[model samples]
Target: MPIAVYVLGLGIFTQGTSEFMLSGLLPDIAHDLGVSIPDAGLLISAFAIGMVVGAPLLAGATLNWPRRTALAALQSVFIAAHVVGALAPGYGVLFVTRVVSALAYAGFWGVAVAAAVVLVPAEAKAKAVAVVASGLTLATIIGVPAGTLLSQSSGWRTAFWGVAALTLVSLLCSLFAIPGGKVSTDETHTVCAELRAMARPQLWLSYAVTAFAFGAVIVTFSYLATLLTDVTDLSEGWVPALLALFGAGGLIGMAIGGKVAAAYPIRTLVLGAGTLVVASGLLALTAESTAATVVLVFVLGLAGYVTNPVLQSRVFALAPGAPTLVGATNTSAFNVGNALAPALGGMVISAGFGYASVAWVGAALGAVAVPGALWAGHLQYRGPRTGGVVAQGAASQEDPAAARARA
Candidate 1:
C-alpha cells in the first residue's frame, strides 16, 4: 500500500535470490573451490545459521536506530558481502561471506517488517506485510531462475556479482523511499522491556503455529522435484516450469490473504493451515496421478503462503512492546521451520517411506498448527482486557477498531 513497502520487497527479492540461487550454483562453486558437493552445500547451512542468530541480535542492537538508517546500513553490508563472496578465492572465504550476507539480510528483514506494519493504517497491515513477503515468492519464480541462467552463461561468480549490483539498486530505492524515523517513539522499548515482552506465553504459542504451519509447507516443497519425477513420472525438464507454477500460486494466495487477513487473522490461519493438511494428504495419496499431483502441488503452494501475512500480522499484534525484537524472533521461527521440516522429511524418506510419505509428514506438521491457532484465538478472546486481549504490551498499540472487529 506504500511505496516503501514495495521498495523493501525489492530488497528482499535480491537477498532471497542470493539465498536460494546457491542451490543451483553448488556444482560450479564446488568445482571452482576444489570441494565436494556436500561441502559446498554447507554454505547454505551457514546462511541459515546466520539468519537464526542475526535476526534478534541485529534487531536488538539497532532497535533504537532510525529505521531508514538501519535498513540502509544492513543493505550496504549485504552488498559488500556479496562483492567479497564473488571474489572469494577459497571455500572458507566464500562461506564466511555467505554468513555475513545472511546476517545483513536477516537484520534487514526484522527491521523492514516492523517498519512496514506501522507505515499503513491498521486495516491494511497484513496487506503491507504481504506486499513485502511477495518478494520471496518472486525470487523463487523469477530471480533464482535468472541467476541460474546467468551462472550457466557466465560463471557462478557472475551470479554473486549480479546480486550485488541488484542490491545496490534496491538500496538506493529504500534510502530514497522509506521515511526517516525510528520504528516506535515509545521510550518503553528498552532492552529489558523487550525481553519481558518475549516472555509472553501467547507470543510463543504464535511462534509455534508459525513454525509448524510454515514448516509443513517446506516439508513438501523441499522434496517437490523428487516427488514430481519419481511419483508423478515427469522428467527433469518439467521441474522448473512446475516450480514456477507453484510460485505463481503463492503470489495469488498472498494477494488474497493480504486482502482478508487483517479482518480475519484466526480464520486465515485455520483455513490456510487446514488447506496445507488437505493438500499434502491428497498429494500423498495421489502422487501417482499426474494431473492430481500437479493440481495438488499448486494447492500446496497457495495454502502454504496464504498463512505468511497472517502469521506476521499476528506477531505484531501479540507483541507490540518490541516490534523489532518480536519481528526478529518470528523471523527466526520461520527459519527454524525451514530447517526442521526438510530434516523431518529426509528422516521419513530414510525410514523406507517413499517421497510421497513426505507429503503425509507435511500433513502431520500442518495438522499441528490448527490447534495452536485455535489456542491463540482462545487466548485472544478470553484474556484480560479489550485491546490487550492476549498481552499487556498489545494494549498500548492495538487499534481499537480492530479490537472491536475481533470482538
Candidate 2:
C-alpha cells in the first residue's frame, strides 16, 4: 500500500466517525433538545437520505470536473456539515445540518473509491477501496466510540466540534497526500449508458448483493445501543464500549478485507455470508450473556463488513464505463440497504419482538445476498467472453494481473 493510501484511509476515518457517531448520541441529543428519541433518530435517517439523494445528484453535477478538485470540494462541504451540526440551535437546525453534511458524505466516498483504485496496482484495487472504507470501519471502532464518550462527558455539541476538527484535518491530508492526476478520459455516460450498465443481469445481481449485505449490518447496528441498554442489562455507561467492540471488529475486517478480496474475492463473500448465518443465531442466543454477546457482536460486525471491499470492486468491474456514477449509485444501493434494514428492524421491535429480533432480521437479510455472490462467482467461472459476461463499459481492472496481461 502507498503512503497516499494511508492518508486517504485516515481522512475516511474522520469523515466516517463524524457521520456515524450521531447514532450513539441520539438519546442525549433528544433529551437536551427536548425531542423524542424517534425524532433524534431522524438525524441518522436524514444523513442517509442526503447520501441517497446526493450520490447521484453530486456525481452527475460534478461529472466533468477533476477527481482531486471534486474531492477537495467535498471536504469543504464536510466542514460545513460539522459547523451546522455543532452549532445547531434546535432539532430542526440539527436535522437540516445532518442532511446537508450528508451530501458531502455520499459524494466523497463515491469519488474516493474511483480515485483510490488507480492509486495502487490493479490487483490491489479492492485493498485500496478497503483502505478508504477502513476509515468508515474505524469510525465505528474509534470515531463513533470516542464521539459518544465526548458527547456524554462534555456536550453533544462538543462531539460535533471534534468532528469538525477531524474533517479539517482530513481536508489538509487529502490536499497534501494525493498525487495530482486526471484519472479518466472516457467521460461520456448517457442516461442510456448508465441504464445499459444497470441492465446487465450480473450487475443487478451485484446490486442485490450489496443491498442485502449492508442492510443486514445496518439493521444490527442501528439498534445496537438499545440492545445493550435494554436486553443485555448493561448500564448506559457500558453502551459505548460495546459499540466500540462492534466497530473494532469492522476496523479489523476492513483492514484485511482488501487482501482477502485480492486472493479470493468471490470466495471471501461466500464465506462471509455464511458467517452471517451463524452470527445472527449466536447474537439472538447470546443476548443475555455479556461475554457471549460481546463475541457475537464482534463476529457479526466482522462478517457484515468483510464483504464491503469486494462488493465495491465488483460494481466497478461490472460498470467501468461510467465508473463515477456507477460507484456513486452502488453506494446508493448499499445505503438503500442500510436505510431499509432499520425500517424493518424498527418494525419488528415496535411490534413487540425483542431487540434480539434485529439479529434474526439481519440473518434473513444476509441470506438474500448469497445467491448474488454465487451468481457473480458463476460469471467469474464462465470467463468474460461467454454470452452473459458483458463488460458494462471499458473494463476497470479488478484483477491487476488480467489488466497487465491485456496491456
Candidate 3:
C-alpha cells in the first residue's frame, strides 16, 4: 500500500465526518434555526441529492485534469463550503451550504477512488479502495458521535467549524501527498468513449449489485436505534455504544474484505451478502433479546460492509476505461440505496410490522442481490470485448498467480 492511499483515506475521513455528523446535529440545528426537525432532516436529503447529481457531472467535467489537481480543487471547495456552513445565518443558508459541500465531496470521492486505483497494482486495487473506505467506518465509530457530543456541549456550529478545520488539513495532505500527473491511458478517453463504456450491460449489473447489497444493509441499519430501544429494551444511552460496536465490526469486515476481494471478488460478494441475509433474518426473529440484538448488530455490520470492496472493485473491472465516471456513478448508486432503503423500512414499520420487520426487508433485498452478484461474476469471466478482439486491459492487469490460486 502506498502512503498516498492512506492520505486519500484521510481525505475520505474528513468528508465522511461532515456527511454523517448531520444526523447527530439535526435537533440542535432545528432548534437554533426555528425550523421543524423534519425540515432540518432535509439537510441530509439535500446532501444525498448533491452526491447523486455531482458525482458524474463533476467527474466528467474534470476528466481531463490531472488526478491530484482535481482532488485538491474539490477538497478546497468542500472545505470552503463547510466554513460557510459553520457561519451560515439561517437554515436556508445552511441547507444550500450542505448541498454545495456534498457536491464537492462527491466529486472528491470519484477522483480519489480513481486515483487510488491508478496508484496501486491491479491486484491491490480492492485493498486500496478498502483502505479509503475504512475512513468512513472510522467516522461512524468516532466522528459522528464526537460531533454530537461537541454539539451538545458547545453548539452545532462548532461541530461544522471542527469539520471545516479537519477538511482543511485533509486538503493540505492531499496537496502534498497525491502525485501530480495525468493517468497515461485516461488522457485519451473522450467524453463519448466514456459514455459508451458506461452503457455496458455488465456495468449496469455491477451498479445493481452495489445498490441492492448496500440497500439491504441500510434497511435494517437505518432503524437500529429504534430496534435497540423499543424491542431489545436497551436504554437510549446504549444506542451510541452499540452503534460504535457495529462500526468496529465494519472496520474488521472491511479489512478482511480488502484482502479477499483481490483474489475472490465473486465469493466475497456472495458470501458477504449471504451472511447479511442470515444475520438480518436472525435479527428479526430475536429482536426481543438484548444479548441477541447486540450480537446481531455487529454481525449485520460485518456482513454488510464486507460486500463494499467487492462492489467497488467490480465496477472498475466492468468498465476499466471509464473508471472515473463509473466509480462516481457507483458512489451515486450507494447513495441511492441509502435513500431508498430507509424509506422502505420506515413504510414497513408504519404498517405495524414493528421495528424488527426492517430486518426481513433487508433479508429480501440481500436475496435479490445474490443472483445479481452471480450475473456480474459471469460477465467478468466472459472478459471485456471490443469487436472481435478481446480487450485484455483490465484482465491482463491482475496477477495471474493470484487468480489461479483463488481458482
Candidate 4:
C-alpha cells in the first residue's frame, strides 16, 4: 500500500534474482573457474546455508538498529559482495562472496519485512507482506531468465555485475523511501524480550507449518524441468517459458490471497495447502499428458504461493514482540523448506521413482501441513485466555468476526 512497501519489494527482487540466477549460470561459472559442475552447485547451497545462519544471527545483532539504516547498510554490503564476486578469479573467492551476499540479503529481508508491517494497519499486515514478497515472484519470472540471458550473451560475471548495479538502484530507493526510525518503538526493546516470545507453542507450530507448506511447493518445482522433458516430452526450449507461466500463476495467486488472508487466515491456509496437495497429486498422476502437466504446473504455482502471505503474516501476528526475530526465523524456515525439499525430491528420483514421484512427495508434505494449519487455528482461538505476550500479540491482529465464526 505504501511506496515504502513497494520499495522493499524492489529490494527483494534484486536479492531474489541473486538467489536464483545461479542455477542458470553454474555451468559458465564452473567452466571459468576450472571447477566441476557439482562443486559449482555448492555455491547455491552456500547461499542457502548463509541465509539459514544469517537471518537470526544478523537480526539479533541489528535488532536495535534503525530499520532504514539496517536496510541501507545491508544493501551496501550486498552490492560490495556482488562486485567482488563478479571480479573474483577463483572458485574459492566466488564461494566466499556468495556467503557474504546471502548474509546481507538475509538481514535486509528480516528488517524489511518488519518495517513493512509497521507501515500499515494490523488488518493489512498480510497485504503488506504479500506486496513485499511479490518481488520474489517477479524475480522468478523476469530476473533469473534475464540474468541467464545476460550471462549467455556476455559472461556469468557480467550477470553478477548486473545484479550489483540493480541492487544499487534498490538501495537508493530504500534510502529515499523507507521511513527513518527503529523498527520497535518500545524503549525497552531487547534480545531477551524477543527470545522470550519464541517460547510460544503456537509460534513453533506456525514455523512447522511454514516449512512443510513451502517445502511441498519447492520439492516438485526442483524437479519440474526434468519432468517436463523426460515425462511430459516437451522440448528443452519450452522449460523457461513454462516456468514463467508458473510465475505468472503465482503472481495471480498472491494478488488474490493478499486480499483476504488477514480476515480468513485459517481458510486461506486450508484452501492453499489443500490445493497444493490436490494439484501435486494430480500432476503425479497425469505427468505423461502434456496439456494436463502444463495446467497442473500453473495450479501448483498458484496454490503454493497463495500461502506465502499467510505464512509470513501469521508469524508476525503470533510474535508481535519480536517481529524482526520472528521474520528472520520465518525466513530461515523458508530456506529450510527450500533446501530440504530438493534433497528429498532428489532422493526420490534417484531411488528408481520417476520424476513425477517428486509431486507425490510434495503432496505428502502438504498433507502434513494441513493438520498443522488446523492446530494453528485452534491455538489462535483458545490460547488467548492464557493472557501472555503471544496471546496479546496474536489477539491484537486477528479478525474477531472470523475468530468467533470459527469458534
> Using Cα atoms with residue i matched to residue i, what is each candidate's TM-score against the true structure?
0.84, 0.88, 0.85, 0.87
Ten contiguous residues with the weakest lDDT in model 3? 383-392
**lDDT (0-100) at residue 47 of candidate 4?**
82
Model 3 stretches astray by more than 4 angstroms: 23-42, 87-94, 183-185, 230-233, 348-357, 378-407
Q: Model 2 over residues 1-407: C-alpha lDDT tens digits?
A: 88778777777788888767876787789789998654565577677778888887787666666766877899898888788778888888888888888888788877777678767776667667767777788789888889888988998999999988988887787887777664444645654566566656677787788888887777778777778877888887887898888887776776667666655777777778878877887887789888888898888788888887777776776765666678888878887786677777767776788788888988888887777777777766554455234222233334534422221
Full ranking by TM-score? 2, 4, 3, 1
Error of 1 at 97 (Å): 3.6
Residue 212, candidate 2: C-alpha displacement in angstroms: 0.7
What is the C-alpha local distance difference test score of each model?
A: 0.80, 0.76, 0.79, 0.82
Top lDDT: which candidate number? Answer: 4
lDDT of 3 by residue, 1-407 (tens): 99999999999998988876765676578789998544665676678778888888888887778878998899889988988888899988998998898899998888888788889987777678788888988987788767767887899999998988888898888888989876334556766787888777767877888888988887676667657777899875676687777778888888788777766777788899899889999999999998898999899889988877777766776677787788899999887776667667767777788889989989998998888887666555543242111112344445444443452
RMSD of each: 3.9, 4.0, 3.8, 3.3
Q: After superposition, how far is residue 197 of candidate 1 from its true place, in Å?
A: 2.9
- In the predicted model 2, the residue pairs found to clash are 13-135
TM-score, candidate 1, is 0.84
Off by over 4 Å in 2: 180-183, 186-199, 382-407
